[model samples]
Target: MTRHPSDAPTPPPAGTDNGPAVSREEFDALFATVRAWGRWSPADRGAWNRVTPDLVRRATALVRSGTVLPMARPWDTSPGPDNSRPALHYMSELGDLEAAEPSAHKDFIAVDYHGKAVSHLDALSHVAYRGQLYDGRTARDCVDAGGAHFGAVSALGPLVTRGVLLDLPAVLGCRWLTPGRAVHADDLVSAEQALGVTIGEGDAVLVRSGSLRRRREEGAWDPGAASAGLHVDAMPLLAGRGIALLGGDGDSDVRPSPVEGLHSPVHALALAAMGVPLLDNLDLEALSAAGAEEGRYAFLLVVAPLHIPGGTGSPVTPVAVL
Candidate 1:
């Protein structure tokens, strides 16, 4: 079904609209306003500090049907323009191995998952804006060729809390949003009102633009060059709500970026400024379906990253319980 342009959500606020390029001055002003440097004070956990025991308990109570869904995309191994460094998987030992006393099978896998292919988490150290990481940590001093010394994915430990899915296409009565479309604060609020849900503090908000749906139907495109996701103007609203985590099908940045001289303004704002870790390249297609089926957008979000000490980020397989 074709959706008219009139059916789209309202555009972002002035100076951040999608039609024109946002000036560097405006972007800088907005970036500084949302910066959380020195706010958490020696706390590398960043926005995740909002997730308390009470919140976790409350979220656990939300699993009524006991439905569990894995949000990670498959570990991609096929190389393409979208997947430059395809993940590796091979059999290290087969049952036919002569040295093995009994039948045995073993395999190994690895990936540089920061790009458009693999589903992965982006730690606070994953992005640096203006030479600094979260909590005013200088990139040069903390992160090096070795790995990040501060705000490593290990510091985040495990997250168990409420997860909110803002199904943009479902709420908008469309199959999916086109690439380069931007989701603003207005879209988020409208989705909440339409879905009878509210994004709250300590919540892990996942925005579904039907990106995977589009890819499956229309074939893959270069998401790095153009993708549908949250614009920079929307972050302040989410930040004001005190969200603990942010994620989407794309990297949570609308492209070609509206901000001048900034490739991914939203990433910079969320990771470096607000200190909110990100779940990138999630397969929200299933979650979108589950939410539509139950008529509830809130669920129990569980994320466990590999315990790679001093690691910048980890390849994660997050689950959402409904």
Candidate 2:
């Protein structure tokens, strides 16, 4: 059965607010401005190549109290408005059936990630604009049913670097940003000032809009339609900062996207243009509380994706050590 866009569940009740509408021409210009083609040798790893050994060591230095917070959301296997395709989890083997001396329980888990529900990483091959991948590689030539040959997740390896949490709610003295709210570049600057932390090169910047909190307190809704996250106007700022990774409670794009005909504009800008990977649907509530308690937002962020050579991306459990 074919499900139309209107057939999907209605969005959460909220104002119809959105970022300023953007034209395709303006978007193309912005894309060119942030494009980092031919900047690095191994184009597959993209911005992650900036994270040298020294940067990793410096990130480790940020662990003060040694409080570790895992940022991945729990495996969502139940269907809901937010999770349309529930992850699959079933027992593949039960030792009791075998009547073995030693009991061993084996289970199988699978998911069609790359949606609003599961917490996952997006590789450079995940998003392409105008049929082109990062570094101006033709997507059709690199990607096929076997998977991506150019920018697969295996090339990125494990990411270890500094992470900056832009807690927008904390900065604004609110519990959460309202649905359909657009977090602009000025919001990023204000968040830096309020949190007293700076986003620099080779850093993983996590923007928390408290969306999960609202989901917990309220109910599940279609984040694709009305979620609070970064606006398209913010991409240039992140590009200028030379950030290696970007993540958020939402998929990191203001819902009802500012760019006309571009649903995930931030994804296109980050992965397709800037060559930066994205961490989506992260559970940042605990990190927010921990950071607030410690009065520090900078931490050692480590994300080790599964080594799937041809895979475009991977589900990840990103850990933050403060």
Candidate 3:
């Protein structure tokens, strides 16, 4: 059987109703406004500090049907427009060793996960804007050739909390949001109203633009060149809500960026300024269907990353339970 490439529709031309173009001065001011420096004791954990013990218990109470949904895309080993450096997977041992008492088969897998093709978490150290990390840590002073000394993925340990899904395609009555489309703050508010859900402090908010659905239906396109996701304008609303984590099918930043000279303004806002981690390239299609069927968009979310002490981030298969 042959596998089709991931879906990517022809995106609209730039400067066509994308959104208001933001200037560098305005963006810098916005960054300053949202910066959460010196707010938490362990600054590396950033906004995750809001997920208190009570919050964890409350999140646990959200489990109802005992249905579990894994949101990670398959480790894409096939090269395509979307997967440039395809993940590596192969059998190291084929159970043919002569000295072995019992035949044993083993496989090895590796990936450069911090890209469009992998489902992974972004640590605070994963992104630094203007030479600064979260809590005013200098990028050069903290991150080095070995690994990050501050805001590494290890500080984020395991994240267990309430997760909210904003299914934009479902809310807008579309199969998928066209690439280059930008989800704004108003859209978020409308989604909350339509879905009967609210964004609260410590919530892991997942926005679904139906990119994967389009990928499965259409064909592969370079998401690094164009993709649908949240605009920089939406960051203020998320910041105001005090969300713990942000994620989506895309990397949570609209491509052909509206901001001048900034490719991913939302990344800077969420990771560098707000000190919030991000879950990128999640396959939220199953979760979208589950939410529509259950009539509730909130669920208990569990994110367990491999404990790589000095790592910037880790590939993760986050789970949502309802």
Write one digit per residue (lDDT tens) for candidate 2, span 1-322.
Answer: 1112122333333433676899999999999999999999798999999999999999999999989899998999999999999999999998888766788889999999989999999999999999999999999999999999999999999999999999887776667788888989998999899888999989999998888988987899999888998888999999999999999999999988899899989999999999999999999988988888788889999999999988889999999999
Residue 230 shift from truth in candidate 2, angstroms: 0.9
lDDT of 1 by residue, 1-322 (tens): 2132224454233312354467889888888888887777447889999999999999999999999999999989998868989999999978886675778899999888899988888999888888988887898999888888999998989999999999888777666777788888999999898888899989999998887877886788898887888888898999899999999988899988989889999999999989899999999988887887788989999999998888888899889999
Clash total of candidate 3: 2
- lDDT at residue 292 of model 1 (Cα atoms): 75
For residue 6, what is the lDDT in candidate 3? 23
For candidate 3, write residues 134-199 as lDDT tens digits.
999999999999899999999999999999999887776667778888889999999999898999
Highest-scoring model, lDDT: 3
TM-score of each: 0.93, 0.95, 0.95
TM-score of 3: 0.95
For residue 248, model 3's alpha carbon misses the true position, in angstroms, by: 0.4
